[model samples]
Target: MTSFTRPFILAAALATLPLTALADPSVAPAKDSLEIDEPGGVPAGYVLKWSDEFDKPGLPDPKLWAYDTKANKHGWANEERQYYSLARRENSRVEDGQLIIEARKEDLKNKPDWGGQHYTSARLLSKNSYQYGYIEVRAQLPCGLGVWPAIWQLPTTDHMMWPDDGEIDIMEYVGWDQDTIYHTVHTGLYNHVKHTQKGVLKHMPAVCGQWHTYSLTWTPDEIREGIDGRDYFRFVNEHTGKGAWPFDRPNHLILNLAVGGTFGGKTGVDDSTMPWQFRIDYVRVYQKPE
Candidate 1:
């Protein structure tokens, strides 16, 4: 249900922070030096592969990112109400060294693909794809009911339908469930509709009010998801068949902030919470040297 169908497909520094630090939403957190394997805490053998520090203040680097608005005319998956805008600075921008993906309560009535939606947002896809690596993102989440923020990955092959090529949810946080964070993996044999998706929910009381690191260390044998250097979820290749593990193919990254969907708006959207934001400090990927 969290699928970004027709999608293309498509950091982090602080190992941990004190509980007191999580209370302030305005106080910025320390920036990670991202030296060597410190970004995702991968093994020393891994080398820096790619990264976007969001240093330039404007749209995301065109060389490394592209927009995904293929399903804007129609509604997005999970019954999301937001229209993913294309190259719109109002929805996606870089400022003060961070990538800000904002979900605003506005209607793009003039756009050809408007579709009568009241909210506009952005969904960014990585221009490059990878088979295996340690990927990391440090971000601060937005709040208020109806906000659904995510950092995930999907296969690059347009031929492979979802749940067949595999999906890796590095992090998912719905504003309605403001205190918990989810990490999951889906495949033909294990998905949400079937009530068999493999996932883990962790209590992150200040997730929406402070900065946190979310990451995926993907290898040939398994995929591990972690936060602030602590692993919480992992999926090991069962070697049974593609139904259970279809992750060998190249996959790209996705970063989006959806609104009023089945998961985020199940309880109903809070209009007062308009203009929610998902702030990304940095994104880094690392892989072993060839």
Candidate 2:
């Protein structure tokens, strides 16, 4: 199913000596240094409210995140290939001051809830939800055909189905389209299944191999998305009712790396790219001071 219909949500190579070695470190430029001090630093007028630096190693902090393990049984709403593992370090973990969500090709057939899938990954949802704020994530994306990584949000209220409640795709990248990044917003009145969603595609050639910030500046009036602090996508409150403007309600964050699905599977997967990693340096949310 297309992301638009799913209720559940959830690479520029380095220049190198040889074609295959383009992404190899030996010939590529030095690794992009982490600007931890102020990576996507707090916006000018907003004050930091919460953040996860992944300073402590092991699984993500339980106080800030929860796993969406239920989707493993039926393959989520998109027919994704990987099982969303819970509390499994191999799927999601923190190391060297960063959070890593790794997708691996493995046979989980022996496990009852495996769903006969050959891959395993993780989907993390923030425990705290907010109505509006400046949200930012600094990370390096994964590349290879069939990989789908996303940083997005969904309404926090239960029983609030998609579209009707709203979905915000702060950042989405398909491995097949290595040079572009997508930002989209979905609502009952505007969604992809209907080919009416409000979205934008930005050419970011270095996105997959370097560290960059993906952010959203949301308010009662509008929602703005950006890369590296530069706003590139915006959706204003149409004042047409909840169908078009659900930003007034609180929403929780989600970070996940999915395998071949409707969009990600368009060109088919390269099993050779069996292992991929989505590294997140940090995530911070800021809001106007009360």
Candidate 3:
């Protein structure tokens, strides 16, 4: 389920540090020449339409990102335990040329909708949206039980609720299942709750410690997902109607690190693994040449 919700009742806390403290001066700037090991270069006809190399350090480019600060005591749907922070750098930051989203064990007892959750993290959404394109995210995942990190997409408009509008999960990892990564798609007619969602799991032993390119190529007829340029899953439109294919409209990107939730906490959380991090080196979107 989507982690978007409204604030609940809780007292406001005192002000915290400014955003400047989020930058890490010790980490040298990333070299612009750093290269990823994608299987091949851009496909023959696609053109780069947008990209965020995260070359700059600080809060994420304001022009490109917006925070998902909705707080719910019950984890927004999957029984998550993080209070998505919009004012704290302890949860989200840009450093050493990468976007770092961290989940820490700490309770903001006074914050609105504070439900005594002992963790805090960040969720970011791309301001821009597109109908169909080749989307790629280069990242090093976080590990340890209870950590659920994801790179996914959702419809840009609220014309319909989740599942009805569509959801594309390029990559989803649960620390307990440290060796497997999931690629899934949810629609009204096909969803996990109904036991009919379209998905696949790929085994990659070193996923947490190394950087990998997770990608999704969406077109009018189908959606394909992969890692390091090798596609492992494909879902095609069945022409059965919108219930099964709600991807025709523009969809925006979401990057988040959730803690101790339905899937991630199935094996139960190792609170000792309190603080975890998810890092993204770059995100790029390309469109087919007309």
Q: What C-alpha lDDT do the candidate models reach, one value each?
A: 0.76, 0.74, 0.73
Which candidate leads in TM-score?
A: 1
Candidates by lDDT, descending order = 1, 2, 3
Could you give me the TM-score of model 2 versus the true structure? 0.85
Tens-digit per-residue lDDT, 145-198, candidate 1: 988888988777645466666778888887777898877777787765555667
Question: Candidate 1 at 253: error in angstroms?
Answer: 0.4
- Tell me each candidate's TM-score: 0.86, 0.85, 0.84
- Stretches off by above 4 angstroms in model 2 are 1-42
Clashing pairs in 3: none
> What stretches of model 3 exceed 4 Å from their correct place?
1-41
Candidate 1 lowest-lDDT run of ten: 12-21
Give the per-residue lDDT of model 2 (tens digit) for 1-290.
00111122220110110111111111211122111212333567888777899999999998888887665655555556888888889899999999999999997776677777889999888887776889999989998998888898877654555566778888888888889887777777776555567777778986786899999988888878888867877778989999888777677888999887767666888889768999999999888876
Decoy 3 TM-score against native: 0.84
Q: Tell me the RMSD of model 3 versus the true structure.
A: 10.6
TM-score winner, 2 or 3: 2
Clashes (candidate 1)? 2
Clashing pairs in 2: 11-178
